[model samples]
Target: MNTESLLRDLREELDDGGLRGSFLVRDLHTGQEIGLDADLEFPSASLVKVPLAAATLERIRRGELDGATQLEVEPGRVTTAGPAGLARFRHPARVAIDDLLYLSVAVSDGTAADALFELTPPAEVTRMLREWGIDGVSVRHATAELADTPAERFEPGEVHLAHALAIRAGTAGRGHPVSQLDVSRASAGSARAYVALLEALWRPSEVDAEVAARTRDLMAHNLLRQRLTPDFGSDATKWSSKTGTLLNLRHEVGVAEHADGQVFAVAALTESRVPAAIQPEAEILMARVARTMRDHLRSR
Candidate 1:
């Protein structure tokens, strides 16, 4: 396919919308990355689940957490509206660690993430990331990275578990104070680093193989829609991803596998004053960029 033409087309579409933000797309195979204000960070929203999932598995690897650890569903912890809406467990159903992580990522389950955090929490996860060379993660909630972590003073040892679980619980339109600005303060992402994180999660040569594989496995089962690969191509185009949207932000960062060992890392973050009910416009913006990146990979 002619990728350049598609890129031009997508760029024009983005321009027409006048949305505010950055984007980044890279061909993992050829190592070519395209960026446009791609460093701007929006709320990770649910998108932060990707990294938090990695943190959970990494904890399991260290034996600090048994993915099989069970947790109970508690009131005030599980929102009445999100993935944890059914709430009526009085016995404290001890959910397994892996299951909790899966629920948190795949379904963006709030109670599930809360259960996991109660086990190992966010401050600890931030510590692990520091050892892993990850910087600029706002030290917000333990569940994800986007809305909570203030970019300027990321801490490896603060209680971020509650913050982590909130976004996953399906709370929409909430914004943190640090999230009011770009450059880490406003909890946003540039297309470049966002895609970089996905590479670290899916492609082993790019990140720890065990962590990447485990993370990919989690995403495959936690899809909210039949978009991307299935929407654009086929098994010839397999995508492992997690998306985030809240208030004025909409983002999706993931890995897509194409024919002939071709892989691509894409991050699409957009912002608007409209609410989540109007998120489709944001989706259209991201889809244009993602499709262009996929096409770009095939051209290689």
Candidate 2:
């Protein structure tokens, strides 16, 4: 099918699936690409961790921070729960800076990310990205800030109410009553921006080669595989990715390397119109849409 018809059909499919998103798939070698609203920015959720890892690694490379340095981490509150990693720690433990990077990216550990953030503040992360010539992604706060959403205020059974609020309370300008969901206030990036980041990691330019290599290694070990992994991973391919989620929003950005020496960078940033906390179908739809874009780019 032609690009126009494919995009139209994909857009319709996303609408039918109750999702609106920014998606991009690019051939790292040729630079050809395809997408839907690929430049539209959204609150990045845990996606900010990738840049955080990159910045942290860069600092280590500069000898400003030692990867072997261990920091004591206190256990997270039960109320501010997370799915895995340091957030669920029941006791204080000392973890090295390198291990914290692993927990932050591989397990989506917010506490580990915040610990790293203490060493390299949000402003410094942004500054490091700019120094490396990466743009469009802004890191304004630590991962702990993401846990303070209205979803926390609601009962677990009524968390969907917070999702509903997230769905309805956004402005056309991307402002949200919930600061975490607001692009202006939250860590934010577009699919295109993230794809650029992936490209930088996969094929370094201004970014330090060692830093990019370390970041890529961390993503390769990412355990949160329920998003784009199903569609991208296989015996013949390697999918290195990071997932970002906030109320009503789901996103993943990664590089897919095939056995045939082909490489592509994919980024999907989405928001659901539906008001549920767990939407398996939404995850499936995101994977399908991203895979479709990747298939199209490859076929060309």
lDDT: worst 10-residue window of model 2: 77-86
Tens digits of lDDT, candidate 2, 196-229: 8899888958899999999999999999999999
Model 2 C-alpha RMSD to native:
0.9
How close to the true structure is residue 9 of candidate 1, measured as C-alpha lDDT? 65
Off by over 4 Å in 1: 1-12, 75-92, 142-188, 205-207, 226-233
lDDT of 2: 0.93
- Model 1 / residue 262 / CA error / Å: 0.6
Which 10-residue span in candidate 1 carries the lowest summed lDDT? 78-87
Q: Candidate 1 lDDT, tens digit per residue, 154-223?
A: 3434324333332233323434443342333433445666776776665554346788788898877656
- For all predicted structures, in order, the TM-scores are 0.75, 0.98
